[model samples]
Target: MSAVLRRSRKSPAKDGPAARRDIPPGMRPPPLEPMRNPGLSRARLLDMHRFLRLNRVLEDQLSALYRQGKIVGGLYSSLGQESISVGTACALEPGDLLAPMIRNIGSLLVRGVPPLSLFLQFLARHAAPTAGKDGTLHFDDPGRSIIGPISVLGTLIPVMTGAALAARMRGESRVALTYIGDGGTSTGDFHEGLNLAAVLGLPLVLVVENNGYAYSTPVDRQFAVDSLAERGPAYGIASESVDGTDVLAVYAATQRAAARGRGGGGPTLLECRAFRRRGHAEHDDMWYVPRDIVAAWEQRDPIDRFESFLVEQGHATKGDLRSVEENLAAELDETARQALGSPYPPPEETLRGVYAGGD
Candidate 1:
């Protein structure tokens, strides 16, 4: 046998006995069991379901705001990529930073940004996170320690790389996570950013959320590789391809990746396999998506997949799931409604933070 194959299969116990051990009634197997491919625990699975459900609630609220004209300008929203946000953010400590993309509403919420502030930002209202400057996108959150949701595509990579470099210099071990789409992977800044992170061994997490499309272009048309996860090794970073819709899978992979970063092991590249259920933006007609293909990926919706996982793993009952969804919806609705009733940013303070290190 080839060396790689032999090493991968040299389990202490035989494949049959070890793999087919009978569990006692309802009890599930332990998580973190070493294998060729690792899986998540029942608890993790339950958490994932809750996270995505909450995400859907938030998305609904945002959609309502847009429909009501309370939300202004472009909304580069993402409804289906909830697992990347929920899974990775859940794994972070209090002080960690998320340098996000335009579609990272879930990441902001999970990182402890107030839902009201998120709504206000969407509305371009005063106290709108960015003080009404940013429209329908969030970035300014001192309370949550989030740096941004840069709208100009891949430019955030270099800025995030610098942030990670600064953290390393300041002796702060907090990990900085930055997202790149499959399309962003080809940008010069992406390469430059990752190259520096790897060389400096910066404590950073680089997540490539491969949702099969970047804007409107499919992965097959953009790249030759099967998974974006393969790019990590080129930068000498430890990496993995996770089932992005399964929040548990994303969480497990991120936890391991973050550990690799903070343990002085440098950066870790993670590819989150997800689907873009919504259009590129509200303005898009989404004519590029084939009807059959959309239907197929939609069937594997992350939130639904996770609910089944919860039931199959015996982590949650139907009532428990319902309660979680109900509570989250109520909370999100309150936040959004309150935002609608709130005041806008003062016109006098319009030019506030353009220049830093001053009052």
Candidate 2:
């Protein structure tokens, strides 16, 4: 339960649906119903709004760092697609595993990766979780049940499939979830992983973020099917689609899917229909994307849409949303500043993990 919602339910005067009953008899409106299916509490909805803002602010900061030549490599942003990751991560339990792609910084944060560690990875600092061995958002924390993304596009699918199988063998009530791009679905590993998971009935969830393009390649050129979820049926897996811009909708779908997986059902494929508002990486101009396409997606911006929903539903006020942005902005600012000051790995540490030593 969310903190605010808990507080509200404790008192009838200030929160929940009952508080609105104080309006004049003629002015009183119909009671606001809780969201269906997942039934997320008011506080959880507000937290989703906060995560959406944090994801956007963090990526925006990374873009600025890249332009200033402060970051070591290409900076990838999930600019228009924050809800999928944040929503899905919110649905997961503590022991559940996650293998997120480049666009899943929101998921990492939701899974407890500190803002400073994320910036440190971008800075390629010795202080990073990966100790400068890997640049970008490619660090893993197995102890935390979060594995870093592999650069080989669809490879993480198979890697997570292995984890799912391991969980089943260990009799653990854990599901392994992984993110992949629309382009990644064409990879052999994607098929192999999903196929194996279906055959063995592994608790795996595949989230395909179909952001319209595979870097520069458009979706029409990539697959014949109109929706990526369509491919799930062929693999004998259940699948569904959701409005990627709506945080509550995404959370509801993911929560159901994750529950199904943990309940001994096979994998589920969720195709999130969203657009990448930025280039594949900061270096590309994204000139290939149509201006009208970008404009259309901008209007459906996930954070903005969710914030509006929260306010319209009386769950959060404009001031409440603004407070979230301000807090995250300050937090991200300090995170970047400290990361920029962190040192690089020393030459002596270069070969530390390169080879095995004899016992």
Output the number of the TM-score-best candidate. 2
Estimate the overall C-alpha local distance difference test score of candidate 1: 0.72
lDDT of 1 at 86: 85
Report the CA-based lDDT of candidate 2 relative to the real structure.
Answer: 0.81
> Candidate 1 lDDT, tens digit per residue, 1-359?
14433543564344422233442111111122111113656565566566677767887878776767666876665776787888888888778778778767778767767677777877888767677877654465656667876666667777777888888789888888878887788788888888888898887788888776676676666777767778888888888887676666777788888888889998888988776777677655455555455576676666776666666667787889989999998888788778888888778776677789543
Give per-residue CA lDDT, model 2, range 63-142, as digits (tens).
89988989887788898889889988998897999988989999998888888999999898899988888877798888
**Model 1 residue-pair collision total:** 2
Off by over 4 Å in 2: 1-37, 356-359
TM-score, model 2 to reference: 0.88
